[model samples]
Each structure stands twice: as structure tokens, then as C-alpha cells.
Target: MFITLVTLLEEVKDILKLHGQMLNTLLKNDSMPIMAIPDGVVFPLANVEDVIAMNEKCSDPEFMSAVVAMVGDIGGSSLEDATRRMMKFLMVPELQRHNELAATFNTHSQSCAIKHRQQDTLEVLDLSYNLLEENPALLGGLEKLSTLILDFNNYNSHVKFPYMPSLTALWLNKNKISNLPIIVEEICSKFPNIRFLSMMNNEAAPSYFNGGSLTQYVDYREYVISQIPSLEVLDDTEVQEKERELARKTYRMQRIREGSRKRKELHR
Candidate 1:
């Protein structure tokens, strides 16, 4: 029993020593560069002071958790403070290599210069639930981005999207989009590879769904499909083969009628 107690006491001492070493490393004011640490390593410390201290010691962090930790709870913070803190982290060179980014609920506008060093490597970006005054040029550099979620923003009819060749899926639900024709024209011209698009709950969508009729919904879907030939999924519904054929026929007939009217005007 005495031997067992001695061994247990030694084990406890060793454990305490190891913990002390870890604490020293975390609390140390040494000038160790952050890039020396392996990519994607999480700092186990809590609080903004420790995080900022570590950030100063490290040249770059794998994730923005430390920067976000500085902001505390996002819900309780003001929009300006949240946006400022998030932008500080986003400007980091190491964080730019990350494929996915979520900056939701921050009131950021087009004036915010959200640029990254490795823009081409980014794939998925979510900027939902923000007060975006206009579509920012931050997306202009992200050529390889495929999935972009910008739901519940301040986008209106005059807003224009940057040309993104690799973009496939886009979510613009609950935005202030009103002019369907102009936006559709811009999308058709700019996003040629876009296959999935959602604009549900926008101003233009409800106008088409007057009285909530299924036929009106179909009409809205068909018109959007006609405008954007590359679209396969629209507003969470898949465009069927029959609908595609019908849309094509409708588009061709409309073009023929417009051509006839133009010719008549020219002759007059």
C-alpha cells in the first residue's frame, strides 16, 4: 500500500510539471514567429489578451479564431466593432489560403476592402445576414470561388456582380432585388457557368407569385430559366427537361416577335 501511494504521488508530480511547461509556453513573451508553428494549429488559451499576445509573437495564425476571440460574442457586439475585428483577421496572409470563409451578421459594405493575398485558392464564401450596401469588389479577385452565399443583404436592382467564370452556385435570397429582367440579364451575361441560383423572398419573386398560385410560380421559374439558359436549379427547385424545352420555345417566339416589331419600326 505504501509503494502504491509513492508511485501515485510521483505520477501527480510529473503531470503537474508537464502542465506548468505548457502554461509557460503559452504565457511566454518570446519572439517566436507564428509561421514556425504548423498550419491549422489551435491555440488552447482563452481571453483576448492572451490571444493578442500570441498573435504578436506569431507571424501568422492558421485560423481567425484568435482574432474572433478578441471580439467576444458577436451577438452582443456592435456592427462596426464586429466588422472591424473580422476585417483585421481577414487581412492576414495565412488565413487567405483557407478555402471556406463565413463573415455573416457583420454590417460590412462595398467600402470595406476585403482583399486576400491568395484569392484564387478560395472556394466557398458566406457573407449572409449583413448590411451590405452594394456588392463589394472583394469577390472580384476570387476567381476559383464556386459556391457564394449572400442571402439577406442590401442588394438592389442596380447592383451588378463581378464576372466569375468558376462560380456555379449562388444564393441571394431575401435581398432587396426588384428588377428581375435587369438582374437576369446581368447574371446571364456575367455568370455563364452558374448552374444553381436562388432569389426566393426577394421583391421580384413575390410579385410573380401573386395570390400564391402554382401556375404563377411555374411561370416565374420558366421565365428565369428562359433568361438564364445555363440554370439547372433555381430557387431550390430543379428545372425539368420539359420546362427547359418550353422555355427555349418561349424565348425563340419572343425574339421573333421583337424582330418583327423592330423591322416594322425601321420601315416606318
Candidate 2:
């Protein structure tokens, strides 16, 4: 009886070992489950070959969505090459359903030139830390885009906001902006639907705020909020009811002054 019990225990251990080996093999295989990829894997561009392999194992659309969501930047031998590769990858019909995209730390002008055939589904885009002097024509295609992050870019007075009727949020931190009035005018004209705006750490903002004094900051905030009535947030802070009231009064007075100036000019 003792001998039979020992043999049965040995058989159970062997079975458990075999099961562990099988699981490891499945995990190592290219056909591993999509969820197996760590959530922290933000940059799939760092391992394009692995992404390509995963595409072979999974359906193109599934792999494409996963890769698009994970990729941070498209790195290549050159800016043009990277842009071309990114365009080619994104042009895949299966990848069109992705709604969010990040193409930061790349040549913004070059990437913007690459016509994105799948712009319809894109709603949020991060183009930060790139060399973008002006609003690119590529934005015209992304009609549904609501959130655009252009932080750490090279935008200045020469840049104009593209007419994006659906844009609700914009991030312009750490840029070369020096003309607050021009930017506010552009927002009022081009982005009527904007609800959130961030212009922190910009050359224009600090200079306009007179070296970041609280009084100047409040004045700046009031001016911006007045310009864009739909704005609910400014520089990460929510617009309060009192602030809104002040903004409305300021806006009314500014309009009255402008009207008076225009009337005088017309008479002349």
C-alpha cells in the first residue's frame, strides 16, 4: 500500500511540471494573447520587429490597434524615413479604427505632411516635443479631433490655429509663443468649441503676466476666459462662476470700446 501511494505522488508531480512547461511555451510563442503585453509598454516603435511578428499571429486590425495605442514615436534612420514608415504603418486599412494617437518627439513638419488616410476615427492626438513652426495642413483631415497637445514645440507668432470646429482642448506649454493677443484672437476665430486651454511655461504667457504676478495672472486669465466664452478650464484650473462673471463684464466693456473705436474710424 505504501509503495503504491509513493508512485501516485510521483506521477502527480510529473503532471504538474509538464503543465508549467506548456504554459511557458505558450507565453513565449508569437501567438501569445494580446493582454500578455505589459501595460507599461508605451513605445512599440522601440521594437518594430516584434510588432510585425505579432501582426502575423493576430488579425491585422487587432494588432494594429494594439500597436497604435502603445507606440509613442516612430523612429527610423532619418526624419523622412520615419515619417514614411509611420504613414505606411498607419495607412493599413485595419488600423483605421484607432481613436487615440501619439507621435511625440519626432519631426512634426514631416509627420504632418504625411497624409493620414485614417483620420476620421482619430479623436485625440499628442504631437509634443516636435519642431512645428505652424499649424500643419494635416489637421484639416482630422475633423473629429477634440484634444490636441502641442507642448514643447516651436510655435510662434508665425503659427496660426487651423480651423477645427470640434476641438475642445488644446495644450501649448513650453512653446515660443510671445503674442498672447494673437493667440487669443486665433482661438476665438478658429476654435469656437474649445473648453480647455493650457498656455503654461510659454514665453508669451510669462511676459504677458509681467513675470507671473498673481494680479497679472488673474488679469490674463480673465482676458482669455472673456475671449472664449465656452472655456471651462484655463491652465489646468477650472473656471469659477465669479471668474466667469468678471470675464463677461470685461468682454462687454472691450466690445463697447472696440465699437466706439470702429464708429470713429468709419466717420473719418
Candidate 3:
């Protein structure tokens, strides 16, 4: 029992040390492999067999419980914190395999800046609180991205993005949007696949749900529903069939006529 406990402690130490190296290197290399070990980390084993073996043993639920039992939890304190970090650190490799990165903050990198090969791997992204006023110069070939969070940005109606056919959800809560039809048309044009959308706290999406007057909220929802035929949820509410039917009856003809007028003006 004593020897087993000592071996477990040693394994935990090695895992944390290697994980620290990986995370530091991953961050510094911008999610790419490091060509050489960075300074300070002394050259060690040439292969990852040791780390893999250690991870497999440490990840066993029974083994984890045994180690924790030996360590003895001390009332939701440092030991728990360290264990939580270890579990999350171990998951980094698995998360990297799927490339489904979410909220990897400080990448303030525009889509054009990321490597082309890595761009399509991104399916979910959170760019919230970035203070962006307009959509960045997003290049083509991001064919897999489906969810985007732009909450707390400074975008207004003039904001625009490259035509993305695969984007299904967008979060634009607490932005600077006052014009309703203009932004709605932009969304329809850009995210032709948008199904879930939120513009809460923007003047354009005013509703009693966020302390806005209830009177015009219905108008807001109806107009948006009329514009985007693919939208399933607006803000926080699911679009009902009855509401959709009413929206179509209310604004479908008006939208068609307006579209016709725009075409005529452009032609002339």
C-alpha cells in the first residue's frame, strides 16, 4: 500500500509537469506543434510513451479515487482545486483532436490570420467581449464553423462579414444596433444557414425580456421571422408555427415588394 501510494504521487507529478509543458507550448505556438522544446524545459524522453502510460493509469476512476482517498480531501480546498486542474489538463489532447475549441481567449486573431488548414477545424468559437465594431476580414474556406459569439462587441448595423453558408447560430447580445431592417437584411444575406440568433440588449431587438417596452417587441419578432425563413429561435424564444404564419401574413408581401424596389433602383 505504501509503495503504491508513492508511485501514484510520482505519476501525478510527472503528468502535471508534462501537461504544463504542453499547454505552454500550445499557447506560444498558436495551437501548432513546437519544432523544438522551448528554453528552460530540459531535454527529456524522445517519445511520448511515458506520458501516455502515465495518463492511462492516472485516468482510471478507481485509481483516481484511491489516490484521492490517500490524499484525504480537506473540505473543498487546495486538493480539490489541484485535482480539477489535473483532470482538465488531461483533456487538452482530446479536445485538440476534435479541434472544437471554444473560448480560447486572447487569440483576438482575425479569421484571415489563422492557418488555412486549422480554420476549417474550428466549429465553435467565442469572440465575446472583444470590442469589435465591424466584422473582421474573414477569408473564405471556413466551411465548418457553426456557432459564433460576438457578445459585448461594438458592432452596429454597418457591421458585415464574408458570406458564410454554414453558420447556424450567432450571439450578438449587448451590441450597438439601432436599425432593425438593415441589420436583419445583413444577417439574412451573410448567415443564410442561421437557425438560432440572439441580439438581446440591442435597440433593434428590444423586448420585455430585457426590460424593453413590450408593445414593439412583437413587431420586432414578427419582422425578423418574416425576413429569415430559416430562423428557429429568436433571442430566447422559440418561433411558434402560429407566430411564423402571422409573420408571413404580416410582412412577406411587403418584403417582396421592397426587394423588387431595390432591384429596380440598382438597375437604374
Candidate 4:
């Protein structure tokens, strides 16, 4: 019994050493929080000072137990650059747990700057209020992305949307785009899965500004619904339920016919 107790104690000591090493790594990077929770608990000591203070004040046994339980309930985590003072405070771990991590580059950056590339796991990305003209290629790879908020980013011109199979919501408001019918059409052509869309506040060319009208925009929006005949909403509002259903079905049949015709011509 004595030997068994000694062995267990040594194992516990080694585990504490490992946890200490992990805390040290997080402290040195300054990006992650230095955590000091006891075994079987997770406490994200994020950059928010007030939250830290609250946790410290409530460090009693009961409070610690409750806080540790609440740790896994974090909303989300943010990644920010260490150099920018204003942005450094935006690093909240709650955001990461809730799956809302926004990535923004400083105005001083001449090129489009992206800090994180955990594409397979990321869900929401907000790159608003920047000046990235080239349509950064990093987003093209995030297949699991549900929402993309790029409002106020100065693109100076319209940019293409690459094929994202799982994209449902898109926000590209407050840009200098004069025409985006082709861009929209490409999205409808490639990513027929999108349901929520907001291109408001963009100065689309008068000739291409067609919201309800059929002839103003490019044929891409029509093309998308034809492929994914179950799309329920556009620009966040659900369209006329019955009317849109009929229209989508009709559009799908038209696309099938057109596709078949083109294939026949190629064979000929």
C-alpha cells in the first residue's frame, strides 16, 4: 500500500509539471492566457481584465468550482496582433467558444493581413473596415464557413467570390463596387448553397441595381436557385414562400434544359 501511494503521488506531480509547462508556453506567447486551474477543469484566463478580476475575487472553493464549470461555456476566442494597442484588448476567449472570431488588419498595413489560418475549424470571419483590393485568397479555402462579414472593407472595385460549398450568409456592404452582377452570378454559378445574402449599401451601377426586377442584374442569381432548388431566403429576408418555390422549380427545369442542349451541341 505504501509503494502504491508513492507511485500515484509521483504521477500526480508529473501531471502538474506538464500543466505548468503548458501555462508557461501560453504566457510566453502572450496570445493565449496563462491558466492555473486545478485538475479536471478549464479556465480560460482571457485578456479581459475585468473578467479576470471578477474571477480572482470569486476564487473561493464554491466560486472556483462554478467558474471552472463556466470555463467550457466560453463564447469565442479572438486572435489579435500584439503590436496594436487598441486591437490588443479585443482578444476575448468567450468569442472563440461561441464561434465568433473576427480578423481585422490595422489601417497601417499596406497589404491585406491575415493572422489566423485554422480553416477547417473556423466558422465566422469578420474582415470589415480594411483596404484589401485583391480579394484575399485565404477565404477561398474555408469550406465550413457559415457567415462572412466584409462590410466597410475598401475593395475599390468588385471582387470575385470563389467556390465555397458551405457558405450560407455573406455581407459585402459599404464598398466602392459600381457593378457586381457578374460577381453575384459567379457565386450563383459556383456556390449554389448560399441562402442569406446582403450586398446593400454598395453603389452597384444603376444598370445593375436590380433587387426585385429581373433584367437589372446578371443571370447568376437565377442560375444558383436553379441548381439548389430549396433556397428559402435572399438578402436575409425570406421571399414570397409559395411564389419563390414555384419560381425556383421553374428555374431549375430551365437550367436542366439549357445544360442538356449545350451538352448535345458539344457531342455534335
What would the TM-scores of all predictions be?
Answer: 0.59, 0.56, 0.54, 0.43
- Of models 1 and 4, which has the larger TM-score? 1
Model 1: lowest-lDDT 10 consecutive positions: 1-10
User: lDDT of each prediction vs. the true structure?
Assistant: 0.58, 0.59, 0.61, 0.48
The deviation in Å at residue 265 for candidate 4 is 20
lDDT of 1 at 257: 100
Error (Å) of candidate 4 at residue 25 is 34
Candidate 2 TM-score, true structure as reference: 0.56
* Model 3 poorest ten-residue lDDT run: 71-80
> lDDT by residue for model 4 over 1-268, one digit each (tens)?
1121112222222333334422323234434442344554333335345434544545465654443333322212211111121123223446333322223222222222222236677677666544446655567777788888776666644476677878877777666765554656655765667777666556552224434334433243443334445466554346455656565776778779999999999999
Tens digit of per-residue lDDT, candidate 1, span 176-226: 887888888878877899999999888677534334467667767778999
- Which lDDT tens digits does candidate 2 get at residues 1-268? 1121112222222232334422322223223222334343332322434334443533445544454332213333433333434444433433322222223323233343223225777787766545567566568668898988877677885577679999999998888877888888987888889999999887557534336777768878888888888989999689998999998898799899999999999999
Better of 1 and 3 by lDDT: 3
Better of 1 and 2 by lDDT: 2
Name the runs in model 3 displaced over 4 angstroms.
1-108, 111-117, 253-268
Clash pairs for candidate 1: 34-58, 34-59
| Leading candidate by lDDT | 3
Candidate 4 accuracy as lDDT = 0.48
Evaluate residue 63 in candidate 1 and report its C-alpha lDDT on the 0 to 100 scale.
33
Clashes of 2: 0
